[model samples]
Each structure stands twice: as C-alpha cells, then as structure tokens.
Target chain A: MYIADRSGEVIYHPDQQLIYAGLTEESPVADASLSDGIHKEVIDGIPQLVLVKTVGYTGWKLVGVIPVKNLAADIDELQWFGVALLLFTVFLLAFVNTHLSEHISRPLSRLNLAVKAMEAGKENVEFQEEGCEEVQHLAHSIQSMVSTLRHLMDDIIEQEENKRRLEMEVLQSQINPHFLYNTLDSVIWLTENGRYEDATRMVNALGKLFRISLSRGKTVIPLKDELEHVRHYGTIQAIRYKERFEIRITAEPDTEGLYTLKLIVQPILENAIYHGMAAMDEDGEITVHAWRKGGDLYIDVQDNGLGIPGEMLDHLLDESQPLKHSKGSGIGVRNIHRRIQLFFGPEYGLEFFSEPDEGTLVRIHLPALNEEQAAAYQKEGTGYETKA
Target chain B: MKRKHKNLIQLGILAILSLLVILSLFIRDISWPEKAERRVEISVIVRESDSSIWSEARQGMAKAAADYGVELRFLALGESNSVSEQTELIRQEIKNGADGLVVVPAQTEALEVIVKDNPKIPVVTMESSLEGACISVMPDNVWVGEQLAAAIEEDFSEGHVLLVDAAPGSSGIRARLEAAEESLTEKGFTVLRCGADFTVETIEGVDAVIFPEPESAVHALQLLDQNGKTSSLYVAGTEERILAGLEYGVIRGVVAWSGYGVGYQAVEQAASAVLGKELSEPVVESVLVRKEEMYEIENQKILFPIGH
Candidate 1:
C-alpha cells in the first residue's frame, strides 16, 4: 500500500524511504492520481488488483498492489511435478515393453537359431520342441524329416556296397583258364612218357588245387586251407618246371589259424615261378612264407630269380595296367590289390619289394580275423573289426 | 553383435536418466546460495510492510539493492510500537541470514539493545538515530524547525503561537519541538506549549498553531478545520492534508523534507557499512512551501515530489 498527496508528493508508502529519498520513479497509481475507487492495473509490469481510496478529507491516495505471479506459484510447481511424473511413467513403460516383447519372442528366436544352423549344413541340430504348439510341432516335424533322410542315406550306401562286391566277384571269377590247361598238359605228357606214378601225383595235386579254389563259392577261407591250396599249386608247378626251381611253403606258428581271402597266395606263387624265376637255371628257389604281424597276416612269396625292374615295380599295383606276365588269373596283381582294399579297407593290400637280379618279394597283407569275425565277414562283406 | 548393440542402447538411456537426476539435484536451481558471488542479503524490519510511511524509504533501499547487488526483504511487524515484537523480528531476520538491517525504528533506545547485540549485522536507521546504528539518514531537525519558524515570521511579527508536540517520546520529534520553540521565542512571539491531543479550549486564545511532526500536522489541521478556527497553521513537515490545508487558507506555511533522500541514503549507508566502504553522511533538503508558491518548479520538487 502507498499514499501520496493530491499533487503527487508522497505522504506514506511501504517503501516510504524511496519516496522520501526521491530516488525511485512514481508508480502508475501515483502518476494517474486516481480518485477513490477500486482499480485493476499493472504495477512494475505485474498485473495487480489495486484499491485507490482517499484517506478521509486529507486527499491522500492509498494504493494496494498484488503481483499475479505470487497467486499462481503453487500451480506452476504442480505443473512441473506433473511433467516429471509423466517422464518417469514413459521411461518405465518403455523398459517393461522391451521385456514383454522379449518374453513373447524368446522361443521363436531359439527356433530360428536352430533352423539357421541346420541351413548352414550342420548335421547335428538340436530342436527344443517348446513354446507355442506351432513351434513345437515344426521342430518335431523337422526332427522326423532328418531321421527319414538318414535312413535313406544309409540305404543308398548299402546299395553302393552291394554293387562294389558284385564287381569284385566278377573279377574273381576270371581266374585264367591257361593254368588248368597247362596242368592237364603236364598230366598227359607224363602218361605218354611212361611216368604213370608221376602222372597220378600231378593229377591228385590238380584236383586238390581245383577243389580248394572252388571252396563252396565262398570269398573268404581259413589261413590253413589257403596254405593247403597254395601247396597243391606248387606241386603241380614243380612238376611242370621239371624241378628246375624248388618251392618252399612255411608259416608262423600262430598264423595258420587266421582267416584270409581265398586263392590270394596261389596267384602270387604262380607269378613268382613263371615271371620272376623264368631266367633262373637250376639254382632258382620260390619260398611262400606267412606270418602274423600285430592284427594283420602277411604272406611273402619270394623268388631268388630274375626280379622286376624299377619302372615296372612302381606301377605293379596300378589299376590302369591291363595285363601282366603271369600264367595265373588275368585279373593281375593290380586287381588283387584293389579286391583286398575293398574287403578290408585300403590298409590291407599287396606290397612288392623287388630288385633286378636280386629276386622279388610279393607280400600279401590281410586282416588276422578269428573264426567268429571270419563268419561275420563272409556273411556281411565288411563285418571285421578295423584297425584304429 | 546385435545383443551388444541393444545393451549399449539401454546403457545410453540409463546414462541419460542418471544425468537428468544429477542435473535436477545440482543444476536445476537447487537454490543453494552461491557463497562467493551471491548478493549480500539485507532485511528491513518495520512496524508495517504495507504502510505508506515506508514508500520512499523502500524505493531508496530498492535502488541501493539494485546498485550494490544486494538482496533485500522487509519483514512486517504485528505490533507497531512493541519493542519486544520488533526485537523478535530482528532476531528472525538475522537467523534467516541477513547481512545487514535497515530499521525504521519505533523505539530507539529499546531496539538499540537488540541491534547492538548483533554487531555482525550492520544497521542503518531511518527518521531517528540509535546508538547501535552504523549510520542514520534523516532530515536535519533544526533545519526543519528554523524553516517552519522563518515561514511563520514572514506573515506575523507577534502572535499567541500554540506549539503542538506530537510523539514526545521520540527523540527526533522532541528535538524538532525544542528547535521550533527556540526559533519562535527568538522571533518575539508568545509561544504556548501543547500536546498533540489539544481540544478547542487549548486553541481558544491562539492566534497561530505549529505542528512539530508531519503526521500530526495533518491531524491538527483537521481539528482546526472542524472547530471552524481559521488561525494560520505552521508545520515542521507536510502530509497531503497539510497541502489541502494550505489551499483552504488554514495552513500558513509547510517545512517539508524529502523522505526519498533520507530512505535512499539509509540503505546506501547500510550497504556501504556491510561492504566495508567509507560512510557518506548526506543532508536531506527541507523546503518552506506556501500555497501560492507550491506550484513553482523549485519548491514543487521538494514539497510535492513528482509521481510520489
């Protein structure tokens, strides 16, 4: 409240000191010199409800001022508080929204990861088979599809194995007819030369060789029986060679019980006598020695005769070679090497060590299978235990 | 990589929220007053916050506050003349951390004890002086008295002059009364002493009346007008009614001082004392304004300040 005389001289004021000091400007009330009334005005740029009343007959004007900002201060504070609360609510909602979205999408995300792994050619993809019914059913269906694919793949492999075994049987059946014709020639020559005892011995050896070679149409035989077949072949061969070269057959003590592919040693012995010992005069010797080395059986057909040259020895087991100098099976050494690998994996096959004029050693390698494993192998083709 | 990116976004949001909390605590106007650069706070305690008596003084203090970068608050008092109540207000202002005080003292001697007890808060008084006051800004009482006497002497050489004493307990009003009495006596007039509560019986034989205080000047003028007494009145200071009295031919002369100057210098001196600056004692001018010359530019500025 403020008071001023009729002529604007200040009489009293809340800040009367400034009016008396004459240091402040006149307020709008004083400047207007208002009469006795209530008024609305702006004082110092503040809207105020002012009352202009005369102090009795004194002609003094009293002015009251109230700034509007003071009236709405609480409202302004409430507005700011409302804004802060709204911001907090929005932040909390966003936080919860993300979590809820993750909850609904979690299982789908796992399923997608599994499917992607499968698409990237992974063989072992795990499906959780959880979450919504659609996702679980999809996982189950994919697992069943994978099981069917594995069975089909196994059937295809079995078919391929059967085809390979049939091709090997065809090669085994092509044992050369020249060996039988030559043995018959020896028998006929002995009978006409008046060596009837020698003829009978040769006939007996030929019959034993043929019986063992037939072996009930079986592809696998015992090691002792294989040695017997090779011995009969050697007797017939010695009679044909007119004792120009001697044949020796021996085996390690425990090796004769092991199983091997039939007709394997007989072919190698035939090669040794005809090709390796062809140039030997009377001092030629062919030794058939068999031994068990670890879990494998090895038969060495060695001839102290003319050995193969370096160039011929490198490709002796090459499948591309069509023929060889042997009066035995035309399937040749390369075919025999391949057939052994097909039965016992590639680790068991023929290995040749030869030198010119020093003789040749043809080592036939086969798995040392006991009786139970031999039966399994003859039935299922490759049921023997493989080396680690 | 996608997971890492999402985590980074969450961390960014958390960082922003943390930053907002920190800003709200430290930077969104926590209202902690700055120690080194904040304005010096001063509180003015007075009998009433809305009274017109403090208008000019508040303006001057406000001007000084603006100039010195000081913060000022005027606390209103419930009791106009209660020493204890004003003293408690002073304590409250000091307790609220006032650096200085501008007191329009109601009881000079009694309030002096409170002011002196709080020596750390510099004090400047208005209208009167207190012993504990670091400075006081007031109109010179002797100058006002002599001006009122000189204005009276111009019209009357001799008369039964009734001297009215208002606020006898106030030292400033008492000095003004004594000075006016001495000046009136020296001018060869019959000076009669009277209290501000005078009845018609006291004014019966009076040829002239003199008021020693501004508020009482207007009050005495109304009493004379009511009694239909036209004896010319002289006053040591002027209020609005005294000006009206001058127009009504009831007022002979008015010795008016500029309250604005006194109020301005009070806060100026108080702020100076607070800042350890040298004190300036300013003289507030008093003028003898008559009805005929009240409109003159020179006398009007002092007698009727522009826009109050």
Candidate 2:
C-alpha cells in the first residue's frame, strides 16, 4: 500500500493495514478526492504533487493511497541491488584506502623518525625521498638543512680556533719577555752582591733557554729541547721563589728522540707553579716526569703545593672560555690543551686531577717522535742527565 | 667309409632323440576331442617397472591375447639391466612346461643362451630382439630414427643437430642413435650426440635438439630451452615432451612417433606369430608437429610400448 499527501508533510499509509482497520477518525480524505485539482501520481507509492496550496479549493493537506501488495517485488529487488552495490563500493573503498595509506604513511613515518633523531642531536640521519613530489621535496630540504647546519658548525669552530690563537699570541708576548726580564734582574742582583760565578751560571741558564725556545722558530721540538725549555723555566721560577720550590726532572734516555709541540710542557709547568704554589710560604716541591709509554710521549708536571679545589678542576679543561680567576698569564694550560687538540686530536689534550692542599698532577700525552733530539739535549745540557 | 657312415647314422639318431627330449621337456599337456589343441603357455617378460607406454602395451597385449585366445602372462624383467631376471624367468617357465616365450631382452647376447636351451620353443621378441628369436616385432628403430632425421632436415636443413638418447650401451637406443646420426649426416646435417643423462651440458654448440624416443623428450626440451637462449628451439621426441614444450612455448617444432601404434603393432605381431597366423605388415609413422599443431586434439595418443 502506498500513500501521498500534497502538503509539505510526506504521508505514508499501509493500504492493507488501513483497509482492515478503516479510518474511523474524520480526516476528510474521501471528500477531497473527487473535487480537487491534484494530479494523479504516475507511479504508485511516490508523492506526485504537494497538496498544501492546490489550484482547487481544498485543505492544506491532500492524500492519496494505493494498495499494499503493489510494487513489493520491485522494492525487494531494489533493496537487494542496493545492498550489493553498497558492499561492492565498501570493498573498493577499502582496497583504495589500503593502497593510499601504504603510499603516504610509510614515507611519512620515516620522515617523522628522521626529524626526531635530528631533534635529539644525531649527526647522521637519513630519510627516504622517492615518493610524491611534496615528500621528495621535503626530504631534500631536510637534507640540505642538515648539510648547512654541519657547515655552520665547522665555521664556528674555525672562528673560535682563530680567536684562541690570537689569545695565545697575546699571552706569549706578555710572558716571554717578562720571564726573561725577571731572570736578567736576578742575574744583576746576584752580580752586584759579588756572586760572579752564580751570575755566570744564570747567564748560561738564560742562553740555554733562548737557544731551546728559538730552535729556528720550528713549532715541533725534540723531547730533549722541550725538557730543557721546561728545566730553564723551572730554574728561573725556583730562583724567584728564593729556592723554596725544588725542581726535579726525571725521564728515560731513549725518549730524547721523541718530539713534542714546543712550549707545551713549559706552559703546563707554569700552570702548576702559579696556581699550585704562588701562595705557599716555606717550601714548594715540583717534579717533571717525562717518559715513553707504549707509542705515546708522556710528561707530568706534578707539584706538592696548594692544589686546586675539586669544583674548579673542570674549568681548567674548558676551551670555550678563558680560565676564571687564574693567575698564570702565559699561554697557559688552556693554550696547551688547544694546541694538543689542534695538532693531534681532542683525545690527546692535557688532563689533570688536584685535591685541596695535597698536590696537583698534570699529565700531557703526545705521539712519540725520533733520535735527533737526544744529541741536541746532550750538546745543550752537559750536566743534565736522564734516568735509564 | 662304412664305419663313418654308421657313426653318422648313429649321430643323426642321437640328434633326433635330443630334439624329441627337448620337445617333451618343454611341451605342456592339453585335453582335446578330435584334434589335439595344445594349450601351450607363452610368457612375455618386460623390463620396466612403471611407465605409460608400458601400461598401454599391456592393454594392447590383453586385447591381442583375447583375440588369439592364448594364455599370456607378463613377468617384469626386474630392475637389473643385464637381463639375468628375464633369463631366470624363462628358465622357470621352461621347467614349468611352457611351450614358447615372448621377451623384451635386455641384452642381445643373453638371449642366445636362453633360446639355445629350448631351440624348438619358438621365442618371439618385442621391442628388444635377440640373435636367436624366430620373430621380432618392435618399431624398426633404425627406420624411426631415420624418419626423425628426415623430418628435422626438412624443417631445419642447415643448423647443428644434437641427438639425445638413453644409455648408448642399450641395444635399442644405440642402434636408433647410430641410424639417426648416419641418416642426418648423410643429408649434410652436422650431428652431435649427447647421452640422455647429460644432454644439457653437451648442448653448447647445438642449434636444434632431437631425442630418440618419448621418455627423454622433456629433458631434451629443457636442454633446448637452456641452450636455445631466445633463439628458436626444435624438438623431436615424445608427445608429452612436445605438449609440454608447446604449452610453455619452449620449442619451435616437434617430431613425434606414436607410442600406441608401436604397442598395438608389437602385440599384433607377437600374437600372430604364436597363433600361426599371417603377420600384418608393420607401418612406421613419424609426424612433425609445430608448436601450433601440438594442440590439435586429433594427435593426442601415447607413442611407445615400453611397459608391456
């Protein structure tokens, strides 16, 4: 059964149910059917016209009804076909969804992982770039950005390196002449006090310092020259301290051939003295231990003077800034650390440990070199001998 | 002269007596009304254990045995290639009073001794004929091999031909391969021989491949596929190999002989000999099937009597 209302409302009636149970309510459907200008529905069940304002005078609602048995077969067939079409469309959509997700999600997940790794400061991060244009472009941009960042870091390091060398030059200009002048002042004071042989010995020590320091201005000096340079510096420091600081040099004979960066050991020794001993009163003991261990040349500038506090130990190794509240004015321990890092690598830099007042021990590790310095040390230090 | 003639007479009588003794020993008894219908049993021994050609041959033998009304028993020649089992089977039948035998002998020389023991027993050979058999009915292998060569020459006249066959020591395969080589070479075809086992390795310089029989055609097609290398491969052998090659588009052409016909003819010939009937003339047929023609359903018959 079908029902239609020409009004705005869509009215549906089951004809069999309606006929078996007649319309006992007075709805005026019988009166409007004969006298209305409402056109007949072309097919059953569907509403053909709105009955709200018909051309003929009828109420706002007009109704038409068809029997229930009509069009049932067609409706059932239509429902079945609709369900089949819905299932087929759902299957096709699922297939397309799976395909599209694989294409889009896989590369996106890789990109997400790469970005996460980069954010965590990983150096080498790779991304897959062989998909759609946008993904490929994004990957390419990320790779380019990483490359630029690496290049910028390298530039920053180079600039900081130049600044550090400038500071080292400034320290050297201040300390080298000051040390020479102090040694010359001591020699003058000794000669006026009628200690002529002692003044002559000071002159000899000063000459040895000058010869080892120059070495024709070659940056890499044999272990002997490096040792002699440190010895001369220590001798001058010992005299200035009024013989309160004792200098002991211990080394192996065969290690004279090994080369070290010029002035590396001397600067470390200076840091040990000023930072470890300048406030001391009675006696300051300093020992320079040089030896060859494995393939490396080791030099230790150990002192029994007032040691550095534990909290300030890390500051001694930091190269990003100058040492805070430090009194060694020469191209000090920081310069030595920087030079070792520049020449060999960061791993070969100066390392140290110090307690409150027990002592401070500084160990310098460098690659070993060859025999020419053994002769240079013998010719230079006639009385200076190495323990076998 | 008298002494010599007397001794010759005695020797002739002894020979006749020996013949009589051999006949009595092998002959089985029969019950008859007017004329004695001798119920002589003949055993056919086949070499293979399992094959389609063997099954078809058994079918044909059953049909022929029904037509001739002769009792036929099939004994497997067992797995040994020396025919010792077949010789032992013949000896067992002879002791059991069997009158005649049909044998697919493994070796030609072994058959001579088996036949000599009962000279009058009338041994008919099928597929494998020995020196002493009274009648031999197998595909004339030389003729079949020659037909293959002719078909190949007609199709591909100018390429190097590789002939693949089973073990060359086998009497049947050796004769066929030699004939194929001889016929192919006579027609100016450079014939290269390869054993069935290692045909692929030896197919290096060959242009077209020809195998002697149906059993090894698949292996031949595989070798051709490997050696042909996108070039045209021609196969001449079994229907199964040809069909497979055609299905996979492996071979350009195939030359096959009918296994069923060989089986039918062999049985008919053997049955005719046992029944004292006139033999039907054997027809040897070889056909060249191009890859397209292999699928023509009219030609799908088995082409060898290997089992029966």
Candidate 3:
C-alpha cells in the first residue's frame, strides 16, 4: 500500500487499481508511493529493527525503509570493501614491483653491459654490485667468473703471444747474425774492390737496421720507422743480389701516422728480393705502396717476378711449412703473415695473389693507429713494441 | 599511672638504642662506600690562549684532580689559537715523565704524524678532540647544528644562510658547520661559505654565523671590537657562547650544549671503565640551547667535580 501524507490519499499498491477507502478528501496520502504509515507498520511486524529515512522528491516524500537483515545483503558491504582492499593491494604490489625492478634492473643491466663488454674484448669496465641477494650474488659470481676467465684467458693469450714473440725474436736474432756475417763479407769485398762509400753505406745500413731491430728491446715501430727499415732491407738486398731486382717505395701522406708491428714489412720485401726476382734475367721491379682507405691502412708490396699457382697460395701463408718450392723464401712471408694476423687480429692479415709469369703481390692490412698509439709511439719511440 | 610511666621509660630506652644502632650503621657505610684512596699523578694539557674555555677547562681538571686526590701538572701551550704551540707542548709533555697525558688537539691534520709515532702511553683527550687520540670525549657537534637548523627551518618556508667555518679541521667545528649546511641546503636554501683559522671578521653580508664553540665567539667579538664595529650578530655554539652573548649583548640568538652534562658523562664513562661497571646508555650525550629556551642552560654548571 502507498500513501501521500500531504493529500491524505493512497498513491500505489501491489494492486494498481484506483480504490478509495475511508480517507479525508484533502489527504496528501492520495498521491503517495506507499501508504504513509505502512513503513511503521512493517517495522512493527518484523522482530528485527528497520531503518526508514524520508527522502524528499520534487513533489512528494519518499520513505526509504531498510530492514537490519537486508541492509548488509542489499548494500553488499564485503564486495565494496573487497574491491577497495584489492585496489589498495594492487597499488602496493605495483609500487613494490617498480621499486624492486628498478633496483634489480640497474645492477642486472650493468652486469649485462659488463658481460657484453668482456665479450667485445674490453676487460676494463667495472660493474656495480648491489640489489636483492640472488641478483647481488649472481652479479658477484658473474663478475668473479669474468674476472677469473679474463685473467686466465689473458694469461693464455699472453703466453701464446709471448711464445710467438719469442719465436719472432729468435728469428730476428738469427737473421741479424746472418746479416752481420753477410755485411762483414760485403765489407771485405768492398775493401778489396776499394768502393769505400758503398761499403760505408752498407755498414751504416746494417748498424741502423740492427739498432732499430734491437730498438731498446721493443717491437713496435711507426710507419715511417718501418719504412726506414724497408729502405735498409732494400739496401741489403741491393747489395746481395745486385742488378737482379730494383725496388720502388711509395707512401700516402696520411698513412705516415699509421704504426706497424716491428719488422713486418721488411720480411715480405726480403722474400720478394731473394725468392721471386733472384733468377729473373731482366731487372725485376718490386713496388711497395701504402695508402689509407676508409678506416684501414693497406700496404701492398708487388714484385714482377715468378707468379704463384692458385693451389700453393692457400699454404703460402701457413707458418708451419717451410717454403720448399722456390728456394724457400716462404719463411719470411709466413713470419710476416703470422705477425700481421697476431697484431691486428684474424680479420686483418696478409693477402697474396699471383698471375702466372706476371708477378706476385703481398698485401698487409693493419689497424689505423689512434692518437693514444701515436703518443705511445712518440714516448716509447721504437723500443718496446717488439719486446711487448 | 605508675605502670604507664615505667612503659614510657622502657620505650625511651628502646628509642635511644635504635637511634644509636642507626647512627652506627650510617657511619660505617659512610666510612666505606668505595675506596677513594688511590693517589695518581696526571698531566692536563690545554691548547688554549688564556681564553675562558681554557680557564673553565683548568677548573674542570682541578676538580677532577682534587676528587681523585692526585697531582695535576698543567701545561699551557701556544698563544691560545696556535696549533704549532700545542704540537710543541705535546712533545714537552712526553719528555716531562708525565704518567698519563690528556691533550685537546688544536688541529686535526697536525696530530696525524705526531700521534702515529708515539705509543705505549695512555692518552686521554677531551673537548672537540679528533685524530690520533685513543680516547676522545667531546659533545656531538653535528647534533648541535642539526637542532639549530631544524629550529630555523620550522619558522620559515625557505632560508638563505651563510656559514663561517671558524676552524677548518677542528672536528667539532667542522661537524657542526657540515650538519647546518647539509640540513639548510637539504631544505632548499642558497648557502655561501667562508673559512677562517681565527675570528670571524664580519657577518654583515650573511644571515647567520654558526660558531661551534664558545671560544670562537670570544675571538669573533675580539675581531669586531678591534674594528670598533659593535653590530649585533646572530651566533650559535656552546654554553660559554650563551654566556658570552648574554654578556656582550651582540648575539641575536644563542644555541648551546651542556658542558656539565658532557663532563658528567665523561666521568660516568671513566668510572664505569675503571670499576668494570656496565653502561646504561652510549657514553656520549648532546643537548641544544636556544635564546627562547635560555632557562634550560642558564643555571646548569659548566663542569662538575666527579666526586661532588
């Protein structure tokens, strides 16, 4: 039943029929949604307490009645509280996750960066060590392992490099003694022939070569220094196989700053003089050309003498085999090949090509010397690189 | 009536006997609470130039000596502020056959080499002591500055301040200046800095000059007096600073630490270490005194006798 208190008349009922009972004509209950006193009656009927609030409408009073039992069920208290708690929990979790990730990611990224650097052969970057225990421990372990591996690999490389260097030094020493003996023979011949200037030049070139060779016990030389060595070797070859071969040297201005591993270019030229052109009837020409292309420095020594077969070209750079085919001049070329590869790495090395009855060309590629290297070159001069 | 009189006489006799027993017990306990008969000679080295702190420090040494019933040989080094003089005095103390030495180092860096070489002697240092001493007893300077900074921070939204580091390597002064600078700067303030080995010549272009100890205030006043500039200066330091400020009427505000409190703490620490007694708290304590809260530091004793 529904009623309007102002009109004193019924407004609504479960039975929606216009039925007027005993009520005043001017009663406001006539237009009420429910009978005015029905809420009070219902509260009286139930044992539980009912809360009723009078809500004002535009032209009527809305009596909102709520039973104590239905209040919780209808309002859905747990659902709303659960939603709020869930939202707060989600926010808290998000905050923790962000904080944790930020902490973990920094050290992890540093470790990753360190590992990448090590892989890229940079053994000098220090990684930050912090964060959660597992990550910290992992970082520490990785760092430790990297350190151990780095030290061990460094030792191995150093040992191999040292062995290669010792062998190269021994080879150089052997060459020095032989050249000394040869120079003494040349001096004797010059004294007998009375050509004092040529003898003196020979003796001086030998002294200069050995002085640069033994160079305060170092192995590295500037391109200019190496070219000077080349000139000396050419002098020696000119003295040894006179009128058999003529060597020409050309250098780019910018390529002068490039550094070569000590005694690298000379050995190749020696091989060209002794093996390639010694038997040629006419004067054979050996041209040593150096130029910079992009970031790389290339040195090519080409000789117009006996060309190489395609089959022997593969094993020509191999260090183990002695050069047995053409009076064994491959020893010097192999040494040059190994040195170029060892210094600049496998990606850069000596490239050989020959056309039958035309000529044999030896090409050597090296890293472009940087400012620090130039500074080191100036400081160390020509001494320590061969030793190191 | 006759029985009552007899009972009263017996009660009087019992009361007299109880009083005698109580007196005997009290006298016996008084006679022997602990042994106070160990006589020892100690050297007190003061690195001051006839300043009031030096005088108060001597007074403290005298009190300690009298309480312990020991002879105190006092060595006054330098013209008060010279670290070189203090260094020279330490060498003299070592040479004088003093049993134990107490030195207040004048400079932090100077003591590094001096203290490193000397060993096998019990060296007790006090008052803003840092570097090269085995045992150091000084009030927390950073806390003092922090308290002052926090107080200033409460009133203003932001503050622009200048710090005058009176002594550079004096740990007490350095720590205070650092704390104040850090706190004020942390709260977003522009801080200008200056360093002086002696007195602050001028603070006109500054908001505040934080003097870590009272002696520095005296030096500052002396510097100002020489120029005939009696400008009111806002300063902070020890209880001696509070007293100096009150006497000079130049300081706009005074922040002080309890000298007696530091002394009491040192004594308690020494006693605990001597008698193998456990400490209830950390051996060091610090407090602050501001102008608005001058009552807290007014009547407090600067140095108290250990026994008294």
Q: Among these predicted structures, which one has the highest lDDT?
A: 1
Best by DockQ: 1
- Residue A42, candidate 2: C-alpha displacement in angstroms: 80
lDDT string, candidate 2, B29-145, tens digits: 333465665554667776543244355555556655665565777777545343676677778987886656776666667777878877867677765557777767666677656
Cα RMSD over interface residues, candidate 1? 6.3
Candidate 2, DockQ score (0 to 1): 0.00
Output the lDDT of residue A229, model 2. 82
Model 2's TM-score against the true structure: 0.34
**Order of candidate numbers by lDDT, starting with the best:** 1, 2, 3
| Candidate lDDT (C-alpha), each | 0.74, 0.63, 0.61
Q: Candidate 2: count the clashes.
A: 12
Lowest-sum lDDT 10-residue window in model 2 chain A: A15-24
> Candidate 1, which segments miss by more than 4 Å at Cα?
A1-124, A127-388, B1-20, B23-123, B157-161, B174-192, B201-207, B258-285, B293-308
What's the true lDDT of residue B151 in model 2?
64
Tens digits of per-residue lDDT, candidate 3, A151-197, equal: 87776577566546654664555366566687789878987899888
